[model samples]
Target: MKIRILRVFAAVLLLSFALPSVAQNVRYEQQGTAYVTAEDQWIADRLVDQAIGAPQGADAQVVFYRTHDQVPGPVRVDGGAGPLALLESGTCVALRLVPGSHAFVIDGRTVTVRVEPGERDYVRITSAPTGPKVAISNALTFLRLVTGKRDPLYASN
Candidate 1:
């Protein structure tokens, strides 16, 4: 009986520690083509809604968007060379990369993408039970997001 109780207690303690690493629930509001955190929407409203176009003669454009899930705390995004952007839930960031292979590390999740010249790539961040799942998306999918096919949501932690 004592051994069973000890095992159960150990399991609970382990789960408690692991919970922080899991994806955090957050609320978001749509602002033009971007989704910004409801709590801090003002800060991102102007930046995301502005007519930020791809730079002239850029090789490729990559947009990392998190519309569904929120990341815990302020996570620094490492774009191979170094920390390039600070990301949180309900925020999106864009990068222009030379036509080549690159790896972007966000919240400890590494996603590798091959960028083609004059092409645009999209990545979506979704919430999972374990953590955030990063997947590559296409222009059509991003279009759906922009066209209001997908609905914005929030979850309570």
Candidate 2:
């Protein structure tokens, strides 16, 4: 009886280890202009798997490519909104991520976005204020003003 029980346990362990290999793999596809926002933001994301919530491990990262040309410092993500991290680039931001919807706020500009597994979503953010003006402004003050603005894209959700 003891031998029989041990065999059953070993089989169960083997099956547990094997099952994950049968699980689905993430697939990516390049979306045409179909996914772009009304503001002309082009978004590229994965097609495989339902929306991932969060990934495990420290190596998982979300990279933000900011084509907007401004790298906001001391960036932060709203924890209540979703799981996301912020990385700085000269013009792009990289995020260490899981999968799911996220709100990316930089230089006080917020983009409410979603991510898929095994895919890099490239978006051209279009809500930026136009007409560049040269003026001396406090970085802290600017940060406060921009961050304080409740993101319309996020607030409605």
Candidate 3:
């Protein structure tokens, strides 16, 4: 009986560590864009109503790409009326924003983007000589390489 209890306790402890990793893997799919986690989806939905509220046709689209670098830390997004979402290198997140100007604070740097209806915008976060920087670009080629044949919004942690 004591051995059984010990085994159960061990299992519970092991699960506690494993559960966080599992939760991190849960991807929120929306309109061919994928949020890294359910919380990310919820926060984005709240900040930009069109993200998941509309069946189709977002007011605007924004893609954030975390460039591959030697940096070992995750970049976090702040401001823009949404909760923070941590981004790791080699991963990207696409956001649907309401038509307007929104500023996002990433890695302690501010990136302001103007969203126009029916427009697709892209931002890349890279390690710059000064530090981390966000730049606007046409990410079609990069997206194609990372997304492949899979749904444009599909992502896995």
Candidate 4:
């Protein structure tokens, strides 16, 4: 009985450590007017540096993914340019933003994102009952999208 109890305790202890590590892998933060994860920050920095002689302008790269399968239709981004569509679930697209403050209407929600020269910003769009929602993607979701991995965002459906 003691041996069985020890084994059960060991299993629980192992899981206690494992679960938090998994949770820690994804984190979110609000940077300026945009929401971003630590991974997004790194990716944006790299992309910005790679742009050869890219003009010093407030630039933004937006990623839109479906969080709920029940959402009706695709989410749309309008303003600061043309209307960009996010078709299908788990689909992601990048948008280029010009410097200064720009108002973008996602679905039916209007969110104002500010971009500063020489800096790259990120935003994420998700589904909501009222309409589409905009926020920053967590590290795990962003990494899965960028790495072409099977994302849980669509797998739950």
Q: Against the true structure, what is each candidate's TM-score?
A: 0.54, 0.29, 0.52, 0.49
Q: lDDT of candidate 2?
A: 0.38
Task: State each model's CA lDDT, in order.
Answer: 0.63, 0.38, 0.65, 0.58
Span of 10 residues, lowest total lDDT, candidate 3 = 47-56
Q: Rank the candidates by lDDT, best first.
A: 3, 1, 4, 2
Tell me the spans in candidate 1 whose CA falls farther than 4 Å from its real position.
Answer: 1-51, 70-75, 151-157
The number of clashing residue pairs in each candidate reads 0, 9, 0, 0
lDDT of 1 by residue, 1-157 (tens): 9999999999999999877656342222223225433423333222233544553375787887665454465556688689988656666678878988899987689999898886667788765556677899754454445545543332221
Per-residue CA lDDT of model 4 for 1-157, tens digit only, reads 9999999999999999898656544433223214433444455445434542233455544444555457777777777566876555566655555667778777677877666665444566667667666785543555455556664332111
Residue-by-residue lDDT tens digits, candidate 3, 60-95 = 877777877778778887765765567787777777
- RMSD of each candidate relative to the true structure: 19.6, 17.6, 14.3, 10.7
* Model 2 per-residue lDDT tens digits across residues 29-114: 13333322221221111211123322344333344432233534423333446534443322333444566776655435555656
lDDT of 3 at 103: 94
**Better candidate by TM-score, 2 or 3:** 3
Best by lDDT: 3
How well does candidate 4 score on lDDT at residue 147?
54
- Which wins on TM-score, candidate 2 or candidate 4? 4
Q: List runs of model 3 lying over 4 Å from the truth.
A: 1-55, 128-130, 144-157
